[model samples]
Target: MDMHILQALKSETRTGNFVGIATANLSSRSELIAQLCEIAGTGRLQPGLRILTDYVGASHYLLARADLLQEAGLDFVVSSDWPFDLVTNLAEAFVGGFGRATELEKCMQLFQPHFAVLPETADVPDGASRQYCSLMFNIGRSRLALMFLFDDGFILSQERLRDVGLLTAYYTSLLQYSGTTTDRDFELTDRELECLFWIAEGKTSDEIAMILGISRNTINNYITSVMRKTATKTRSEAIAFAVRNNLV
Candidate 1:
């Protein structure tokens, strides 16, 4: 639901409240939580994600930072078991579609799963569905998406999909609590971080200039300074660096 509840769930996960909750509310799904706990205990994110993918009968999974999707690169992708060529071909379109949604729309759709069809030109794995599903959730300030590609003719259960979505949030909470997720301190100034944030949201220098009420040239200067300080050769790279380090 809201960030507060998600944060509390994460805290509960860290403090070993899972068993109690599972017994009280997840009687039928206690096995799922137990499996998640085992995976979380191992401190391996890929296995946890893979387990969720299988739980929903999905053929593949792609976990990404939804906020960074607007940036023009795969840097937003946190982990994926999808085919590389397919990912490369669909990445821009997926990110662009996400960027087009309004903030209110995004907020209303959090943890709600939706599906889209793959283009005819795209190469999909044999026996896989042309349609794919995606669910979004937040961990603190970061918004993450979990995408799934299932087999052809297979009907994904709505109830199971919701369970997978909530379980994913729990799995990530454990990872964050166990220090498996990345955390870095950077030297960028507040202005620089602000510039980087807009850029990652797919803003141009001119657009950011208008939004921040500064000259376009000043915005460009801020971005250039960010690139230099971050040792990134381009604006996209700088934004990618910021996203990977969770600076934005």
Candidate 2:
């Protein structure tokens, strides 16, 4: 199916409102991934890129090069325990809270970004951390995150972040069409993926229930269904599977 860009971008605002976009027609999926790898290596994008996918029957991810992040005193979270501490912490500490489903849309509507900040924290050791900024976003079954390490006096404004997020979504949509995030069988229903998405975001069962307007037990059932389907033993392992497989 072909996705209309303006229409989709117009709607990247909240869950249950996402519109499907067409795959990349300009570049091969490999070429695009390689390009991002080069960007990650160059430190132009900062600590790294984490591309998470939740689709078909699996969840998975691909991290940008590690050497680049090493220079910044950071590393990708271990897949099994990918705490994603950096994302949660950055949102809370710097931006007050993670912005809306459509962060940019909300900003445009309200005339203020959900979270925009200066990259001038004094706690960054040796100024390594100050150069970089982080944000996360979603498009369909995929979640895209990029951290940009900018020159002094430069900031990753909310508008720019949203732009990057959309671009990242474009690239990952290509990956999805190219079958890059799939390997084997693990059938998760739509309900299961919804539960997994919120779980990966650090939402508790009760919180997810409230957000989805479902009962707490129903949320738990969805999660347990995910774990069983994915052959995971614990909630974290199930989420880890989701992350690595790009299911969430």
**Winning model by lDDT:** 1
Query: Per-residue CA lDDT of candidate 1, range 28-113, in tens?
Result: 35667778877777878899887777666566899988877644568788889888888887787787788789999999888887
Worst 10 residues of 1 by lDDT: 1-10
lDDT of 2 at 182: 45
Models 1 onward score TM values of 0.73, 0.43
lDDT of each: 0.74, 0.44
Candidate 1: give the clashing pairs.
none
Tell me the deviation in Å of residue 8 in model 2: 27
Q: How well does candidate 2 match the true structure in TM-score terms?
A: 0.43
After superposition, candidate 1 runs with Cα above 4 Å error: 1-28, 41-43, 173-186, 204-222
Where does candidate 2 have its weakest 10-residue lDDT segment?
Answer: 52-61
lDDT of 1 at 103: 96
